[model samples]
Target: MVKNVGAVGDFDSAHETALLTATGRNQLLDAMHWIAEGRRLNGEVDGPTLLGALVAAADAGVAGAEPALRTAVRAALRSTLDTSADLVMTDGIVPPSRYEAALANVARRTASGTLVDITGSVVMAAQADDPLVIEALGLVAGLSWRDLQARAYARGTSLPGEADGSWSPSQVFAAFSVVDDVVCGRVEPQVPGAVAARPIELLLGGTASGWAAAEAMREGGVSYGTLLAQRDVGSAWSAHRNRSNNEISRLMVRRVLNALDEAGVGYWSTEGDAAVAKAVLGQRAGASGKPPGQLSIVTRAATGGPGYAVLIAIARDGGTARKTAATLLQLPKRFNVPSVLVLFGTGWADRGESDDLVRAFGGRLYTEHTLEQLAEAASTVGTS
Candidate 1:
């Protein structure tokens, strides 16, 4: 049963016009072929369009329409390659943002299974040997309904009729893995969720529990997961600018957690700055989550050994780092525990004209250290 692509959504004269006017003739013909498939098979899904059903069937690994879909997708890929500015918008050769949005609209109009089907063609196109196809697919990689919502939430809004789904932190991680692999030609393209496990491990430090937390964070629509791979202060702040204070703290906490994982330090108890600041500085601490400006991880020198802790302050800019240093100086008397203050940034407070900030604050600073360096640091706990 061939499914007509037009049956799934409320298409109007304008949409048809947009699809026809913005797409090249051959591309338009290829798109129409999916509709034609339904007519040829005399098997219409009754409600949705042929393309919608085809997408569903393909994702389900239904053997009937696989060959036709592959052909149609190849044509779509070629249509994407035309580089002509005159084709119909429906052909997906327009601006990358609009192209992704168009695909998202198609996804939203279909059932869950069908949505995965639609993604297959995009994945197939991405897997092609041609550079243009790869570029186009990369731009449109966030089109899955789930990714669309995540992006929308990032921009501080929800799409119409959107609902939360199961993929989280894994979705962004999955998207990252897909794009990374495709760009590097390291692995054959696969389903976003079905990619191999190594990328996640490599990105998240190979901790099973940490991966679970990341999945939950992603599922709750938090922005922390994708931020994991960002390795510098500038990059971290750029991606984190518009997030909430708690989220900002969470992000900072995750970095510390990753660092601790690398350093082989395990925490006895952990609390974000938001919670700890109130306890350390009182309720007037407000939402700033200041002083530490991140979580304080309590640790021991060894099993059943003396207690120690690490306080982290992430300085995206110098002023923040200076104030954080001032705030951290006061914590020793209040907590009365041996602790280390870790400053994360590039040149935020490396020096002040003549004096070094690390000396004044009694803290360790990091501008660049690969993951292995951190892990080595972790292995030598209490040595220095």
Candidate 2:
């Protein structure tokens, strides 16, 4: 009962149902054949190519291509199912029932034509079922689609159709390939805690799920050094370290704000705006040299008590820590308000560098790694 949409070599009147031009028809047939052969060889489907071809055919009003498209979809789904089965058997991380549910979700989404990137969809489904699947997948896959889009934009590569809220299958698959490579141990993260911090960076842009993921990682004793011995964290962070720093900075700000809120402290904050820093601290530029360049957080007690200005910095080692501390020391003199330094991350080069920061901040230094201590410290200034 199925019509062979590719059997006719040319566009002829006899094939009235085939509305595509001869070239278009040929390309569709070729892509379908390639995907079938690929699946046969290694259970891999060239989903982007096949999906692109199908989309092109539909755009060209080729109604006859539907049958071939359906067949290709079936093949792709089967390939993913097979791979999931193997993962369940080998890693035992994904349960069979969970895989089945994920497959069913993919099937429905694909049926509606909203899920062109089959592999990414599968990984996303697994992520929804268990966020830890991201770690299990070597921390390369399972990023939310929005995070993936942001990362792509940061890399100066805009995924096709991203503006319309539809993901291009090719771009999604290409990103997923990095995950596959990491899963296979073909790539590794350059930084020790980059794996744990990546999701935090990507999801820090106002998503509660991202904050939950960070909290979960912290409670589970997962840190940047937690997976230092694992050889499969992927190099996404190193490849985009500059962007990662900005993201981590944002994450740190959010963490501090959240901690402050939990401690019932009333305060206002800003991100690197010198004017706001001057206004909140009520400091004039005439006598003081200038507002600090990286004035991250400025807050006062709701009852009009003494305010606190916080400078957040990230230091990977003792040298950077010392340099950051020295820089931080210069800013407090410009402001009459009390100043605090909130340092994030692990791996201080030496205890002395931390001591210098504490002494510089007048014993008001806080580390984000300790949330409870951070909250307790933050509560000191504004809750009087």
Candidate with top lDDT is 2
Q: How accurate is candidate 2 locally (lDDT)?
A: 0.46
**lDDT scores in order:** 0.38, 0.46
Q: What digit string (tens of lDDT, one per residue) describes model 2 on residues 1-384?
A: 112233223333323323223223345455344433433322121222233344345335564455444444333322111111111112323454553444344434443422233357665554455534333333334444355555566555565443224445555455555544433334456688764334433323233233233333423444554455232444333433442455556666777888777877656565456356546544422116555655666555555555567667766555665776677767666666766666664434243444334334443445554444445545655443
The weakest ten consecutive residues by lDDT in model 1 span 77-86
RMSD of each: 34.0, 33.0
Distance from true position, residue 189, model 2, in Å? 30
Number of backbone clashes in candidate 2: 2
Mind giving the per-residue lDDT tens digits that candidate 1 earns over 256-315? 667666566665434544454335432212213343433355544554443344555555
